[model samples]
Target: MQNVTVKNRNWDIAAHMYFPEPFDQSKKYSAIVCVHPGSSVKEQTAGLYAEKLAQTGFITLAFDASFQGESGGVPRYLEDPATRVEDIRCAVDYLTTVTFVDENRIGVLGICAGGGYAANAALTERRIKVVGTVVATNAGRAFGELNPLQTLEAVSKQRTAEARGADAMITSWTPDSAEEAERAGLAEFDMLEAIDYYRTPRGSYPTSCNKLRFTSMSALITFDAFHYAERLLTQPLMVIVGDKVGAFGSYRDGFDLYNKAASSNKRIHVVHGASHYDLYDQPEATGQALEKLIPFYKENL
Candidate 1:
């Protein structure tokens, strides 16, 4: 494994490049770009998957989105969907430049909200041959579900504040504590578990700060991750979501992507007994997911 920087427009994307064991530089290898979840850094689940994929003999990269984690951009912690999509394209641009990468066999894998960005990126980025998403969360739809009028009004106020020279307002992407999460109505078992995962010693990291610019809400509410799936998302696609996640409407976006994609080859794999957050780092559940992903990429990429 090596730390690398990928040049993406004005930002230098900080990433971890995982090379397969017994790697042979003389032989070309397929590569997968692993995208991290929103309110997440590349050091978490994205890196986990990238490392596992590399173990399967594919060169993989897990990168921080511009303005988040270690990547460079103005307005730190801003979560702009458009820029996130562009980051994936930039990762692809970097991958194509590597001499040992098989350009024709490049693939992409995204987790959580990153799944949405990956799907969006794959729509117009034809260089990506196959795409995979785990526990996909459509950010637009998720934010839109908040009290519509109140959310919009708040975002509008924040925009005004920013224009008037006020500092960028920052907000916690997730509750900072279990009590706060519960107070915010994240009382479900899975929801509580997710809070713990991001906020506690279980999975917390210095770079995974779980904060975002309040102004980002405006763009996030308007951006659709699967904007043109019916027409432009033609590549082979795989959607993996925990079966239990469907009960909470979290998996609906994944199913929607599978249903709307024009790809002749597309499928959804439901990991049994796993919840939305369980797929983030659970060994057994993640193992099951990779079981499907490995073969899917092998057959498609």
Candidate 2:
């Protein structure tokens, strides 16, 4: 694995590139850009998948979204949907510059909200030849399910306060830990597992602080990651989701993508009995996803 940085507009995205074991600099290889979930850094599931994919002969990259992790951006922890989508494009741009990367065979794999972002980016990024999503979560639809108008109004106020010298408002994606979730009466199976993953050493990373800028809610409430997937997302696509649906709606989102994508070749695979969070790191669940993804990328890319 090689630590790297990619230029994205004014910021530099922090990333890691995983090369095939018997890598050959003189030969071009198919490549994949692994986009991490919201509030997550490259060191988590995205990196895991990239490393695994590299082992199977594909050069892969896992990157931190701008403003989060170690990526360069101000007003840190912002989760702007548009920026996230653009970050995927920038990652692809970086891959295209690598001498060993096959430009025409580039693909993307997104986990959770990153899945939605990847789909959105591929809608216009013709350079992305294939798309794969794991436990896809459409951020707009997920956050829109809340009282979006109310949240947007609050976000407006928060942004104004921050502009006026107030401290940036921040919020966590989940309760700090399983104990906290239990105390807070959060009993959703997926939610509890998310707490266990993000707040514990099991999947936690220093750069993944779990913090999100409160003002980002405004954009997330309005951004539609699948705005024109039916018309513009024409690349071969694969959607993977766990059987256990969660409050975050990844299961639904996966099916929705499979149905809406314009790709002539598209599929949705279910990892039996796995919850959304399970696909993030559970070996059985992730292995199931890779079983499908490996062949899908090979055949498509």
Candidate 3:
């Protein structure tokens, strides 16, 4: 039930800390650094998950990734896989120093796109003992050259140009603008259950820098968050996905790809009939996802 500022390498970020009712400063509680989906902030499903997890004798943190929402950074709303991964580590660093938190037992849970980034972050940051991804995505593979038509070579060339002093522009892939939603051309991409989830009053919240800078294409095209999947991650990990998601098959493949190299106990669970967004804020569905997570963290972290 508090808001604190975490200073990162880039800027000072704002985050809401939900302490369990009847707060006990004498008790060192376990914690979960809840990471939101791409283009999302603490007020969205990320906060919902953090609150639920906090209620179960765990301290949870829901934060806005840098350059988005309430967090700080210039050129706003850009998605840098490298810095986004650091945001998670920065949150963990902040958590470990806070009062009444058992830093050693702290873990993380990322929803949607955040899930993939969390997995990648855990690979290098051994400080995280237990990691969980909800409605996981292989952003790198999907956004990368996972499709032969979208060759990695083309993306790499763009990145190389940027590294050589080209302008930095990031483009947003979110459908958060009503006008943009109308033109989303859903016929082309039905992977999202509903366009409104990313647009309209249902979820869209507008801001000038809310979208990614087109220049970030350089970083994104060449940036594969799970670049080191086969190694680095040795902690207990959990992957939760909606059983009937439109992209369920892809998620399954991503899970299979990483599970092969994860050097620790791991699990994969499917929530029946729970589509992608359903796991985002659906009360019952999110509850189920957490139901699996609570036990997993209890045993692992």
True-vs-predicted CA distance for residue 206, candidate 1, Å:
0.5
In terms of TM-score, which candidate is stronger, 2 or 3? 2
The lDDT for every candidate, in the order shown, is: 0.90, 0.92, 0.74
Which residue pairs in candidate 1 have backbone atoms (N, alpha carbon, C) closer than 3 angstroms, thus clashing?
A: none
- For residues 135-178, what per-residue lDDT tens digits would candidate 1 score against the true structure? 98898988878776787798898888889998888898777887
Query: Candidate 3: what lDDT?
Result: 0.74
**Stretch of 10 with least lDDT, candidate 2:** 178-187
Worst 10 residues of 3 by lDDT: 185-194
Instruction: Report the candidate with higher TM-score, 1 versus 2.
Output: 2
Model 3: how far residue 73 lies from native, Å: 1.2
Per-residue lDDT of 269 in model 1? 93
Estimate the TM-score of every prediction. 0.97, 0.98, 0.85
Model 1 whole-model lDDT (C-alpha atoms): 0.90
- Output the TM-score of candidate 3: 0.85
CA displacement after TM-score superposition, residue 70 of candidate 2 (Å) = 0.9
